[model samples]
Structure formats: C-alpha cells, structure tokens
Target: MRTSSGAGELLVELHRDNGVPLHQQLESAIRTRIRAGLLRPETVMPSTRALAQDLGLSRGVIVEAYQQLVAEGYLISRGGGYTLVADIAVVSPTAAAKPGAGPPRIDFRYSRPDVSQFPRAAWLRSVRRVLNETPNRSLAYLDGRGTIELRTALSDYLNRVRGTAARPENMMICNGFAQGSRLILQVLAAQGHTRLAVEDPSDNDLREVAAAAGLETVGIPVLNSGIDVDALERSGADVVLVTAAHQFPTGAVTSADTRAALVAWAGQGNRLVIEDDYDAEYRYDREPVGAMQGLAPDRVAYAGTASKTLAPGLRLGWLILPSWLVEPMSQAKLMDDRGSPVLDQLAFADFVAHGEFDRHLRRMRPRYRELRDTLVERLAARVPELEPVGVSAGLHVLTWLPADLSEEALREAALARGLGVYGLKPYWVSGDGPAGLVFGYGSLSRQEVVEGIDLLAEVVAALRS
Candidate 1:
C-alpha cells in the first residue's frame, strides 16, 4: 500500500477536519491505490514517522494505518521499520472477478502480442549502437525505400528465416502493416487493378482499406487446407492478400500443393499476391512454415513487420516487391509519411544484425506456447464439448459454438462475467459460418488465460440453461 518516499512514494491527499479518523482515511486510500495497481506490489514505502510528519498527522495515526494494512495483507512490515507492499496481496474475489470494474480487462483480441516480453535491454543496446555508429547524413530524408543497412538486414533475415528471396532494392519499409497494405492497394488500384480477393474469414478492416484505393474486395473461401485456390480463381480478382504461413483467426497452414496452385493462378492471369507474413514467429506444433513468396517472388509481394515480434507502437513494417511493382510501391511509400522513421529502422537493423532479435524470439516462443496450452487445457476441463480448432501455430484458436448459441450472445454473456471473449463473425466478410469464438492468448499471462476460460465456461453453461 505504501511506496518509498524517494521516487516511488504514493501521493495521498487528506482532509483533517473530516469526521473519519486520519488512520482510517489513510488506510482506505492506500488500499484503494493498491487494488488499482497504481502502487504495485513490493514497492518500498516511507517510514511511519516520516509519512506522519509529511501528512501533519500524529505518529500514532500512521502506525495504526500501517498495522491495519499489514493485517489486511496489503502491506508487509519489513525489518528496520520499513514497510512494503505485499508481493502477493490478496484483492477481494469480486474486485478481481470483473476486470473493467477493477483493473484493465485481460483482452483476448488476436491482433495483440505480449509486449511485456519485449527485450528492453537489447533494444536499448541496439538504439545506443545506432546512435553511435549511424552516419550523420543517414538521419536526413533519404530514399523512400528506407535505409540500406535496414533493408539489407531485413533481406538477409527474411531469406534465412521465412525462405523469402528478398533483395534490398525491392524492399520498402513503411509505417506498420496498415500503411503497408494501404500503399500496396494504392499501387494496385493505380495499375487498373479494380478487384481484390481476400480470405472469407479474414480481417474486416481490410475491406475498408481496399475501398480507400477504389478497389472492390471480394471474399474467397478459407478451408482447413488454407484459402480455397479454386474459389480464389472463381473470384476473378486482380490481386489477393493472404496470410499463407498461418492464416489469421483460423491458423490454417496453406498446403504445399495449394501454394503451387496459387502461384500458377497468379502466373496465368498476371495477377499479384501479397504474402502478409504476420506473427510467423511463435509456431509451436512444428518448424514454422516458410513464406509462400519464395515460390514465385516475381508473382508475389512479401510483407513483414516488427509489431508482433517487437511492439506495435513502433510503427515499423516492410514490403519486398517484385521487379515490376517495386518502383510503384516505392513511390506509394514516398507519398505515405515520406517513409518510416530512420532511427527506428536503424535500431531494428542493429537488433537483427547483432542476433538479439533471434534471441528475443527464442525466449518468447516457449512462453507463448505454454500460454496456448494452458488455454486449451482449461477450456477442455470446463467445457469439454467446446473443441478449439486451429490450435497449431498462431496466438489465437477458433472454436465452433453449439447451434443454439450465437457468437454475439456468448460474447456479451462472457463480458458480463468479466471475460473479454471475441467472436469470429466480425472477421467474416460474408458473416457465413457456424457460430464460433476466437481466443487470442497473446497479451495475457498463463494465469489470466486459465481464469478467463473458467469464467467463459460458466457463461456458456448459463447460456445453455
């Protein structure tokens, strides 16, 4: 409850003339802050005498307040008259149950990553190195294609890790995936490419992104084997954006044969494919699949980002274009923010070249896998009838709901119980399918995942009743 006076001290305001005792008022204030997470666990607090003097209260008042908090398990009396927040302070069940009522809800949205695992020290080292090593001229506005150092580093990393045949000249770094997709859509629309085909149960926001560029987006069916190549052909779209390595919301790996068929389809019609290699790192079932761009680099455009691996706020993403589209995409990027920031690009380059990026991913893979396993196990124990599909690779899994339960109803019921459950309907372009839920395990701890599922199971039971 109490924080150190030096820098970590909790600031509390008191009204002496109020009817409430000073000790009780102080105790309530500290308890509230502790539950709110403003005063984190294990934070050292000022000495009782020091605090009493600061608040213009008697030393006895501070001592009584501290004793009460200690008894309640909010603060602990350390040796030498020091008081600290308990490492595992017990928040009331009702307080912990509903997330929005107390702390922030444990969000299960699929687009997130556990940013708490981001390598701060490694990133700082890279940033420091970039500051020291980068030439002065490199800071100025340069080619819209991005810095040669970063493009080269990305080219090598993508080729080695994702099996993409990326060349520095073809790489264009833009602000995150949103901007990357926008730039590509703009270029395609300029080339008289009017129709775009996307996976049926893919990101709905993409339809708006395509519309901005005057291209119409049509939904192509997505099966267990990945996007239905036959359905894609029938759609007759000029360009297709696919998450081949691991499809979003479904985690369906595009099969080898289907990948070849897609390549052929693009070749025959002079169509273009954009390989959105999002969250390709955290695969657990087997060695992660390589990028589909390698199959036909000339027919496909490869896109990757630091959002999943690093943090989304960094606003960093890159696209490797084919020879025909490189200039156009580069020009499109030039018009969009005059290219991504150079400092971040350089730091990321350092992070990659020095092998810290690989090290960070190595550390995160097992943690994310453990979280995914915990979610599956808890849901199975509670709602055995609910089987989670696509538990293979990505941060999320899809589970088909019983015929009676609508995705919307289940989501609302779960939210009422303080669980942030998401439905697959919004992602569906046509909103066609059995009602299903998408559970994103990233951005949540293993404990939170289990607790959320337990609440979700209860919600489902109530819905069934």
Candidate 2:
C-alpha cells in the first residue's frame, strides 16, 4: 500500500504545446481532482515553489492557478502560506452529462446564500476570542435553551434590527429554522392545536413538517399584498406561519392593512402567529420592513436563522417565543438535541456583540445588490415578457412567465441549456398556480448571472418555437 502526499503524489498532466496556457492547464487538472474526489477537503497542497519546481514551471504559474481556484471556491488559503481544498460539493466528471443531459452548469436554485462572500477572517477571530474567553464550567450544561450570552446578544440584536421585543428568557436557539418549526409545531400539537395555515405558494417542506407533527396544514392564498387574511380566517387553522418581510417564491411584503387584519384574526381566534423572518436583512430598496413579532409580540412566535444571513452550514436559528410558549419550546428543544453546540453559540455572541456581524452584512449588501441588479437588467433585455414579481429584497426573485411557457416547460428548457431554473410550481401546495421562475442570485457572480439569464432566454425562445 502506498500513501500519497499532495505535493509529490498528486498527478497533473499539463500540456504546454496543446494551445492551452500552463497556468490554465494546471488549474483545470487540480479542479478535476477535486471534482473527482481525488483530493478531499482540507487536503493540504504543496507550496507554490515546490510544485513549480517539481513541474519545471515558474512559481508565478502555480500562484496564478491557485488564485483562480480560490476565487472559484475550489481552494482556500489558510493564511501563513498555507492552502487547502475547500469543502464544497464534489462535482461529478459527467456533472452536466455532455452539457445538456444532466445538471446545469449554472444553478439558479433559491435556497443558497452567497457563501463565497463569507467573512472567514472575522469568523475565525470570533472563534478565537470565544475560545479564549469561555469559562470551562460554561462548556458544561447550563441551559437547554442556549447560552445566556448568545440569547442576551440576540435579544438586543433582534430589538435593534427586526424591531422585535426579544428577551433573553423568552428566546430558544435551535439547529436551524427547520428544527425551530418542528419544535414549535410539536408543542402546539401537544397543546391541542390541530391546524396550521401556511402560504399557498410556500416551501413544500414546511407543509410536510407541519403534517409530520400531526397538524393539519391549510393552504391560504397569497396575493400581491401578502397572505390573504380573509382566506386565512376562512381556513379555520389554530396556527399560521408567514414570511411577512419577504414571502418565499413570490416576495410579497405583508401590507400594513393585511398585517393588522391577520393580527386581528389571530386575536379573534386566539390563534398563534409563527412569523418566519428568514431574509429580512437584505433589502435593496427602501428600508426593510420590521418583523411582525414587534406589532403583536404576545401573539407571534418569531423565528430567524443564520442560514440566510451567514451560511446554512452554521445550523444556527433562534426563536423569540411568547411567555406562555417559552418553557414548553425550551423543553422540546432540550429533548430534541439537549442543546445546540455551545462553542458556536459563544462565538456568534462575540460576533454580534463586537458588531462584526453588522459589518459583514453592510459589506455584503452592496455586492448582493449588484448581482441582483445585473440579473434583473439582463432578464429585462433578453426576456421582456418575464415580469419580476416581489419587492426588491432577499437573494431570490420570482419572475412570472408568459402564458405560452409553463413553469415546468421553462424549467426543463433552462436545464437543457445548462442553466438551472427552478419552477414556482413545486412551492404551491394545491398544485395550481400561475407559471413562474425563481432566480436566486446569491452564489453566482454578476457575469455568471448575466450569462445564465441569456442562456435561459434562448431556452425560452426554443421552447416557444
């Protein structure tokens, strides 16, 4: 058996005379290894000097290759001249199946945040500070709810940002929004709540989660103003979930009149309002709407997650529960996983307390806005009939398509063109809604967004013909 080191054992067959530059050839070879899982994540690579010397190439060539890979997220520089592979999903050699028979080269799926812009240095600093500051006894079981430091920090952060009257005692941190929803539903079901009403065109997984928790899910219509309050009242559900700031798929902001109506409706029936404040931070136009929890704190159970703001891999979410629901939700959280990891909670507290989180958001907003603008502009030029629905906020936008192209047809056409376009159909509960496409500009670059939409326009033309 032979063991391989990245520097000496790694194989690269660079072609100098094959019309490809040495740097590009080296970059492609390394990328191929990563895609094929030949080089695993965190695998340390040889120094530029060593690799260049071994390959009989200038150090500048290896440096250029490494830089390109880093920008593409295939590699990461760990500072102090250390480089390692990034832990991204490994691409299959036949990932796109001859370009048109498999997954798209450009994924426009709406669930991801712009992870490339993640503040690694800031996060590392926070982690270091937490490690240095956290007492050993603090590492032991303190509270199933979460570390008080995090809850305290989150309480203040939410108050300032989302306008929620969050209190440390009333907050419970969970794995993510999904877990938070599950626990809330479990507690509600245990308390004799039977029905949960959700937006008609919302995440299907959310409906499934409610159903799994033994709550009957009722689908209510979502108009331009937001969830139809009249329809919601008519559903006769004991609990309702809403994405008030920016609705999923459609991006409708819950209007003041509708907000009042929903709160009134909740008051009338003593129903619970589970406000999913998922992506309220990235508002490109005007001031962001405040969380509905603030308007009716006693009635609303506010849920938020770092999945959208930071990265999904963080698996950090918090719920600002009403006084009555805190103990039960906290107990439920305890039984679920004892508690979320303490290290992350402590580090996040430091991150928020030191204002680094705010700084990161401020830095990312402009870049994301740039990507959004490029996506919208290119789509308007290429596909004039595609109307972008929803407010200019969040990482994704829903574009209502012309009647000629069905959502499924458009999605398939886009896929065939190596462009991943998600149909709005799956988001709908009743399976009957207008055709639309959801474009997520979170991960892709501005140039990539433009190229993808242009390809999508061509796909639509072909489908129309």
> Top lDDT: which candidate number?
2
Q: Give the poorly placed runs of model 2, Cα more than 4 Å off.
A: 1-102
Instruction: Write down the TM-score for model 2.
Output: 0.79
The alpha-carbon deviation from the true structure for residue 97 of candidate 2, after best TM-score superposition, in angstroms, is 14
Model 2 global lDDT (CA atoms, 0 to 1): 0.89
- Model 2, 71-155: lDDT tens digits are 9999989778888888888867677766536667999988788887788999999999989978899899857689999999999
TM for candidate 1 is 0.78
The residue-by-residue lDDT of candidate 1 on 201-257, one tens digit each, is 998888999998999999998988889999888887989999998888787899998
TM-score per candidate: 0.78, 0.79
Candidate 2, position 415, lDDT: 74
Model 2 clashing-pair count: 0
Winning candidate number (TM-score): 2
